[model samples]
Target: MCDDLQVSYPKDFKWSSWHVSCTCFLMMTLKTQSELITEINNGQNFSSEASENFIANTPGNFNAWLSENRESLEKRKSKPYFLEENKKFVK
Candidate 1:
């Protein structure tokens, strides 16, 4: 993931904010994908059991989960870049 991130966003770009945001976004996406893949593998033999719990837990389950939890979706709510973390956006 780090390798991909580094390759995707060159270090010398003038848009430092864009580079940082893109790096964070890519990392988060990679994490989510890895987690989903792990879940799929672990549930392959007991898909029904896992599906039952997942369905019972969330009202709309998968769709609602993805909709609410997607970083990519939330990213579009504002500008493509973010100010430094640990502080509010200056705007």
Candidate 2:
């Protein structure tokens, strides 16, 4: 996870107290993609031995997991770029 906070604002952007506070809060709370993925994996609990074994042996489990959790995932700032680039490959 990156500890550095890299916020980009327009040249005419003004620094207000509310803006500053929100920015600070977001910087402190946001997690990187890998970090979020690890967190989700750590929190997962299998209900049955068969299900656990299936996930463990699955070749595309990571992608499957990401797809399943896509709606709940908080995408990073660069998500737009990725979505654009991969749009052609997505069904």
Which candidate should be chosen as best, given lDDT against the real structure?
A: 2
Clash count list over all predictions: 0, 0
Q: Name the top TM-score candidate.
A: 2
TM-scores for every predicted model: 0.17, 0.20
- lDDT, candidate 1, at 51: 38
**Regions more than 4 Å wrong, model 1:** 8-13, 17-75, 82-91
RMSD of each: 14.9, 17.2
Provide the clash count, candidate 1.
0
- What candidate 2 gets wrong by more than 4 Å, as runs, is 1-62, 73-80
RMSD of 2: 17.2
* Cα lDDT tens digits for candidate 1, 13-89: 22333343344433211224455577778884343334322322212332343455456745765543322331231
* True-structure lDDT of candidate 1: 0.35
Q: Clashing residue pairs, candidate 1?
A: none
